[model samples]
Target chain A: MPAPAIQVDNLSKLYHIGASEQYHTFREAIIEVASAPLRRLRNFGRASSSDSNIIWALKDATFAVQPGEVVGVIGRNGSGKSTLLKILSRITEPTEGRAHMRGRVGSLLEVGTGFHPELTGRENIYLSGAILGMKRTEINRKFDEIVDFSGVKKFIDTPVKRYSSGMKVRLGFAVAAHLDPEILLIDEVLAVGDAEFQNKCLGKMDDVAKSGRTVLFVSHNMGAITDLCPRALLLTRGSLQADGSTPDVVSEYLSVATPDGYVDLRHWKSERSGDGPMRIEAVEILDSKGARAGQIQAGEPIRFRLSVRGKSGAKCNLSVAIRDMMERIIYNPNTSDDKATVTLPAERAIVEVSLQENRLARGDYSASVWLGDAMNVTNDRVHHCLKFRIEDSSLGQTRSKGLVRTNGQWSVQRRGL
Target chain B: MNPQSNQFTSAMTADESAPAAPSEDIPELIIEAQKGWIPIHFGDLWRYRELLYFLTWRDVKIRYKQTVFGFLWAFIQPFLKMIVFSVIFGGLAQMDSEGFPYPIFVFAGLLPWQFFSESLSRSSNSVVGSSSLVTKVYFPRLVIPLGAVGGCLVDFAISFLVLVGLMAWYGIAPRVGILMVGPLVVLTVIASLGAGTLISALNVAYRDFRYVVPFMVQIWMFLTPVIYSVDIIPEDWQWLLMLNPMAGIVDGYRSAILGKPFDWSNIAISAAVALVLFFVGAVVFRRIERRFADII
Candidate 1:
């Protein structure tokens, strides 16, 4: 057999919490180094043991993908998915072990990563393409096609700052999608743009996968993963928990649970997009009786309690979406649907949404919460941050056929009596 | 360039053919944890030369984007500095210009000195300023500071025109030794890049370098013979001044442009010091670069 396109062997990365922490000034670094000797003497035993400030972001992750294989990496926030991709792309060095790639590699850790605002769209394409490791000739050859795909031809010469955010995302994804590398690593960049553009990106990615190049994709969107990848790897915490067919790996991922019935959104590390005057602090799932429950019957009432923390007198529109294991929205409840404006009285407040009856099919599900303003600007969003299970109704345990159970009333009427 | 084009063509062909096509032309990449003091990878730098070009181009383009004066600012800055120094040092202080007019002499020194200082300050902050690129994309980290330094060459070229005009006005003709200015300018770049790369890495590790760099650049200017001729220093102590790489560079520019006798010993010492700084800078940058994406 030909050599695998990518081979990762026991790759690990240890992050120092306080040592390389952000916002550290030179004076603090100097003082820390100066006091190192005395501090070490005082905590000699603790120093020799395990330092509390150190945490492994990735540990002993070993996997290999053959040429032309498309593999999806699925994980919760801080599950080392991005860390793994970062290491493979060589954005950040691994702390231990190594990885080998057989051919040229291109990674899209972020879209529009190096696009200078002052540059025109055409110039940004060249600049961003070069940043992503594309040769100038290659970009020249694909320039027309990229512009056509992005649908930003009218603004090609306009400065990028003038383009809408959606336009920017489309242009960015178009450039990345044209990168004809032997190996491609993508990290949740498809989570931007409108649905039509996202579909176009997925179609382009499909074409890329069909071209026989190896691909490693990371995304929180399970539906996209199932659509694009045949095989998948599941990461829990920092370890590779499962690697198998997409179905099995996704099921394994969905079954991984948070403690109790609440997820602490305050410190959760997920791909969050928004400027925040309002933030989601935590989310709690409750059954009909209002007690914390990890699983509810298909017909039982479910309530989502969202603890929002923000500035006093801030106004927001809160929305919650329940999605199935495939990441398809099974149910959506929005405060704006009732024309309700949620006003914050103080620093923290709990806003709860109750479903009178959960008609979701018997399967694993996750809740994504969103906070936005009247201007349609997303103030904060946490996607699929809360996971729970829905069981069959108490009458009989029958597997459902689709994403939701039909609750239509049955009325028999004879048309030709 | 030939090999790279060949690789690209082969990669394209491989993409079009069957998956199992036995083309062994594809290069293998191995990424391992870097230990202490990793050696510089000149090959990687060469391969990423296009990115260096684009980054430098981006800097130049964005620099004067909204400015009304645009590229004229490049000429105006050095010319204004020359006038101010000519009045303050040449007229008020009566500092010695050796032989040439004070404006021409000081302008000669200012040319290399301005390039050095501008490139140094920009490059020292380049890694921190491009934190988005550093943390997201993977290229030779050396390219960031190198591109910053490269971008300053445009301003230097523009300001060089002013110096040329001044020389013509003064009716001072350049000799064949004027070709030496090219090597001296290169030496200045080396010195600036060395210091820039070192400070940029430090800036990433300690943000306080944000305040330290400009202050350091101010102090560094006084130490170099920019406003005055090196002859002002005592004969024995003049050797000590050459230890500062910019001193020799400024002296070399004046010697080349003014057609003065070259100081071979001073130039030699300056070249040696510049090389040493470059070596140290590259080593430290490479050693610390592995952590840049993490810390930055």
Candidate 2:
């Protein structure tokens, strides 16, 4: 199998939780080292050990990939996905084990890693190419292709500061796509950019894979992963759980992810947007029978209840956003859409939204809650606040090719004939 | 097309062995936990030399962009500093200029000192300022600080022309001694790079260095003999004062441009000290480079 394109063995990384936070000056760092013995003596009688501060970001990860294989790495947040990519890109050293790869390696851990805002688009192309390990001659040869691919030919000489964010991302992707390395390591850089550009990138990646190169794709978007990769690896809590066919691995992941088809967000403790005047206390999904349901069948009715609190007499425009497994916003039902603003009392209130017929395909989906005011300002919002699954229905429904399914009538009139 | 599609489908099910990658005798790279003190990888640096150039170009372009003066800002900075120092130290304090006009003498001193100080401060902060680039990609981390120093060299070159004009205004003709300016410029860059690399590496670990640098620069300027000549210092104390590497570089510039006698003893001591500092900085920088992405 051509010596396996890449081989990783017993790879691990260690991180100190709070220790890495207290940044010290050069003098303080020196002083700490000098007083290490004293500090150790002072803490000799402590009951609980201080080892809780240490975490294994990655622990004894072992894997291998054949040449020309496209493998997807999937994991939740803090599952060591980023750490693994960083190690493979050599951005940081591994604390244990090793990774070996054949041929020239190019990693796109971030798009436009070295693009300067002040430099002209043309100059940034060359600069970013060089930063990605492209030689001058190679860039010269592919310069026109890159400019054409970016579709920024008219403004190629203008500084990037004036370019739209989409234009910049397009130009950045163009340069990275033309790297032509033997092994490409890409993180979730495709999560940005417009849909058309993302499709173009996926097409390019398909071409790259067909050209006899290897790819290691890491993303939380299962649709993109399944579309591009034939094999998949699942990582959970810094350990490899499954490495098999894409569908099997992905199903295993989803089944483990939303075990009961729902995640309660009564005490979501992460950072969210908006002021303190409004807050989302809880989110619940109910079935047609008015009972809490984890999974709803396709085309079935579902209800979303957002328990919100605000000052008395304050008005809010409550909304719900539903995203498919690919993390793409498929549906956003907002009170503002209908210009129907609701008034909330000083205490707590429940905002209910009912979906008459859910058209989501058979997959895992996430729902978010948003509370905004009349001024179009988001007063409170929480993302990925609820996870639920849509089970397959036996109504002989025609499968759709998109995130949502819809029924449309089509008839051909023979008037012309 | 139908037959081809059928063959493709059949092949997909028929083959059990993975397809071989296109092989071209490419060597494999093994990445592991690095240990011990490895020397600088000159080969790797050579491979990434283009990135260094591009980074330098980026810094130079970004510095003058959206500015009214553009490159003129380079000249104005040192010229204004020269004028201010000439007024305060020369006119008010009555500092000695060692037989040359105070303006030209102070201008000559400011040329090298400005380059050194600018390069040092820029280099020291380069790593921290580019935390995104450092954390995102893998190249020689030293390129950041080195590129910062390189970008400041353009400013030095621009200001050097103003010094020549000021010397001409004073009717100080060029001499063979001016040839020495080339080596002295190199010495200044090396010294700045040394200190800059050390501080930039430290800055990643301790952000306090960012606040400390400007204050240190102010104090360092008073000690570098930019406004006054080193001859004003007592003879015995001169040796101690020359311990500051920039003292020797400023002295060299004044003597070389003003046609004064070069202080060989003081220049020798400063050159030795600057070389030592450069090596020490490089060592410390290399030692801490691995931890930069993690800590920062």
Candidate 3:
């Protein structure tokens, strides 16, 4: 029967692309201020207004959450996920509409927001605690608890500049975890910590949710979203796409993920280094049917199609290396390794690297390509140029012990028993 | 301070006993941001006073952490400046000190001047220096510059001791009216905070303010009566010089520590001008605070 902890009403935000950019000098300020009236008159005269450069980062976003509800927000890049959190945290003002919260709110848009390297770890805990809006007395009450959680008791009195990066993050997350705000807002800062620390952070978040506080968590990690949140909100192009149970919303989000989970690199605009005679313009991952695959299932055959352009008489052989999320190369297929070379005929050639079966475990992977001649002459090379994911299947464990899965046969003879 | 601690404890107790209050009666904070000026929220500033103190402490702690001289560096700046000015202006140019020893006279004037300039330059950069906190979290943004200004008061305190030493070395004895130093220090801080707040806010939008501020401070020092006595100026134009808040403050310091008659009229004018600057700075700072996280 209680009211919702957070209520948002038609919230929106607009960002000017270029025309409304900042003036960074007094000269620029004077010029702009002097011409302001003329500019307004010109804007008024332009009936068609062809030069409108404003983009709505968020549009009419309305949502409400009951007290103690842990909600997850999921979206692609440029989907206004960050803008929404910024508005809620009051980091930036909303252009229109409003949101209401009924209790003390602590937003961890970033961990270690105000940590000074010269301060000791103990001092930084109090300093960061205050920056996150915790009172001195409250920090006093939980000082030991935070230190104990970070497991940096021995180094507590040492300056944080001396602490390892992992130690600093652990200490930072510990301080944030101990914050007892009635409403906690978190961004993707948890992704910075190692796996064990991330697990501890998630566990602490679970406890916080159970302790009857409201939480709005934003992350690109779908696994974490589904694991921690019972309800999820999906944002696409600044509008709420769906809001429902975690599974339903996640499924909805995944359904809209690039068809077959394959990235099309034909439009890849990142700079590549190579000899001017040859260029690899497009790369893609294709399934058995040659369909663009964003994700490939275990035990399925997959192919990488590299579209290359080269000058006449340019001798180039293609190679690709598949790397896991940690950038550890799982496998590499190289024509030079096989003592073979394919010279460019006239202008363009499509190089195909197909795997009989993708035995990769459930994790994200990226493919990089190189072009060289038979003399081991390097023509062009790109690192982690394309990305894709491997999904779990019946053949492999849900989580693999290593990067790749080998279908090695095992049979037990009766004589052993 | 007592009330803040009491509120902290009560808030803690309230958290421990949460879900006990009638849920229907819980207060809701509506956050509809409109584009316009908002009143100065003194309540929010009071609520975040602890943060202000901590930020000031952080500044002070970080300044001397790895330095060899530590707090002695504060004493060295004004002391060295006094020596340099005495050699050039008092020794070479033979500027009159109006009965006080030239070294002690300049030291007295430099004490307040150094504090004002140091506080002004530091607080002007405070907001931009703490941009990470400004862009990520929401508190009274005014706390940043105010806390930075507070931090410089430590340096002032350190340098004030050097002034006392010089006074003793010159055989100048303190008088009962020296109590006025407290009010003079407060006035200097208010003026610094006011101007610093305005500059910091403008620096958020136009980064040129960064380059402008240092040059402005350098010129500002010459305008203040740090190297010479105010009596050097024509009598009628003396009031015109007091328009610079630091001029009156430096004069008051010399009068107070040297047991000279206090310039009550000029001090009154300086205090009024400082107060006006404080209000104007507050208005400008508050007007731009909401947009700092975005613009910065």
Candidate 4:
């Protein structure tokens, strides 16, 4: 058990905000300052004090990163992702708890972050370098590398105010990339620069990671997160909701997501059994030998065992869906696939629904089981469905990720001439 | 001096020899990440002090950047106010300047007072103006206010040079008491830094503090003994007057530059008030600094 590269222990931050409550006259402000202690005592004497309003920006956040690991932090607005980064960078302190870091953290928090508008690009390079805890000699040694990397050789001496936002970002990132901080903490600011710059930064980050530096990256781009980081920490409203392999956590997050943090559990309840109308108890996604497995190779026969009890004598049909991590229905198998509906008797029974998984390729999949009775009608009154994860290795490489692996092939040729 | 240059993590080029993935590259910024008083390398601050000095210089340079009168404006400000007071308060109303000529007398007081006003106003707003830096980058917050105070020295020097010319014209040599002006000027710096820190903290939350600042400076001028001698205030009200720290500061300047002995009781009051202000201001500023990144 080696020491984690980044160790955060019960970290929290509090911010006191003044409401639009009272408008103090200048004299009142001075008088209040004069009597601060007395007013504080008076406020404390009350059951609750409005003046001491606190916003718990980050709460009991604890996690760590192993050396050279690239971790992504994902969340919506005001989820405390940025606040946590600021604390780790030592730009601010936590109200409680301690965060320990083992390396230098280079952050691209914002463009033109430390550049002086009046100073030339060259001057700002030195200034920003100093701000990142680098010395002049270190900057001098890497100056050429930075200039070349940023592609701002021509305007290196020009005052930064004259530079466009794109140029500012290019130079800013060049300096930061060349900063050689052992642990890189990058926010979404990279998305600000041009697409080319963004790609260049991605490549630079790849190189930084290859060179064995730790990186804690935050972005809303799920595609980018899956591609860049091997592991991820998902934040939701100032708490660590999940921390695990990229694919598993992302799938869980997607399933439980809402438009505005208002979670719609329609999909979540579908996969949960044992407390529904039919009294679905346990579900096992099995292989050919009735062996339970979390995954299988694409184009293989997958089995689903769902146990349920029928309280009334109603003919029931079984339906199960195979969806990817995003909950998109990749394949839905019905018990009527044999051209004959299998009717359920009025009693508690164990049932099995097996389907050929040949069409699916190598990727992660989920099983959604539903029990319903609607033999005479096209649609059925379905009960609850259970969720289970299944892996298919037939798509392509075992390492392939995302919605699923598609074995689609393409060929390019010139027109006959 | 990138202190970190020599502190890079141990490299395990061969995979078989590597410890793990993430911790392998963590930088050694903290003396001991897990424990003890993490000593701030003041030497590191010193190495980068040039940027600090330049920022201060930049603030001073930008102040007069688009203005027409340039450095002369620094001189004209206290000079004009000195003439106005010399006419209205000193000549017509016949106020005492310790028997010294009114222009020189008032100019001396105006000099320190102007420094305090300009320094305090700029320092209080320094944090808000540099919010981008505070939120986006990491540096000591104390540096911002210090730079503003440091920037005023340039203007102070320029303005002080004109005071020497005024003295030569009046043929009034600075007395032995002039030596005391050094400590008085220092008290002004400390006092201004104190007030600046406190007001800057408030400025972060209220934002109305920015608008209130100029008005505060105006009212503060009337409260200080810049226009009149402290001797004229009734003894009963003088105790209340001593509460304004700048009161004793300006009077000390008059006593210093005019060859009068120091006012012991008044100096003690000013010292007590200025120290208290600095202590309270530093604590308030430290308390507010935690949320600056979020709120700013």
Index of the highest-TM-score prediction: 3
What TM-score would you give candidate 4 relative to the actual structure? 0.66
Candidate numbers, best lDDT first, in rank order: 1, 2, 3, 4
Candidate 3: tens digits of C-alpha lDDT, residues B63-169: 98889999999988888888899999999999999987899988888888888898888999999998999888889899999999899998898888887887777
Candidate 4, residues B1-296, lDDT tens digits: the string is 13353123213123422444354653455311223323334664575576676578667766775578878888888778888999998989888777788888888888889999988999999998988888887766777887899898778888888888988999878888888888888888889989998899778766878898899999999999887888789876776887888998888888887667788788779878998998788778877676677666
Tens digits of per-residue lDDT for model 4, A1-417: 777778888888766655332333455667768898887888785766653455677788889888789998876546688888888887777777888787656676775567887777888887787777666676787787678778889999888889998899999888887766668888875566777888888877777767777889887666678888889988766788899998877776555442121212233332233333454445666766667655555556777776656655556667767665334577777766645455456566667777754456454444555666555332222222233434434455454453444556899999998
After superposition, which runs of candidate 1 have C-alpha atoms over 4 Å from their true positions? A46-50, A258-284, A289-300, A304-386, A389-417, B1-24
lDDT of 3 by residue, A254-296 (tens): 6564445344444543324455457777777888788888788
| Superposed model 3: Cα runs more than 4 Å off | A19-23, A38-52, A260-285, A293-295, A299-301, A304-359, A363-389, A392-417, B1-27
Instruction: Enumerate residue pairs that collide in model 2.
Output: A312-A346
TM-score versus the correct structure, for each prediction: 0.83, 0.83, 0.84, 0.66
Regions more than 4 Å wrong, model 2: A19-39, A42-50, A262-286, A289-294, A303-322, A328-362, A367-387, A398-417, B1-27, B36-38
User: Largest lDDT belongs to which candidate?
Assistant: 1
Model 3 chain B lDDT-worst window of ten: B1-10
Q: Worst 10-residue stretch by lDDT in candidate 3 chain A?
A: A263-272
Off by over 4 Å in 4: A12-59, A91-96, A104-106, A136-145, A222-228, A245-417, B1-51, B234-240
- Model 1's interface RMSD: 2.1
Preferred candidate (TM-score higher): 1 or 4: 1
Give candidate 2's TM-score: 0.83
Query: lDDT per residue, candidate 1, A1-417, as tens digits?
Result: 988999999999998766447567778878879998998898766645346557788999999999999999998778899999999999999989999999889999988879999999999999999999988987887787788778899999999999999999999998988887789999998888888888888987887887788999999878889999999999887899999999999877776765356888887755455757788899999999899877888889999999998888888889999887555788889988968778887889999989986788887788899998766579899887888988887899866576678766889988996
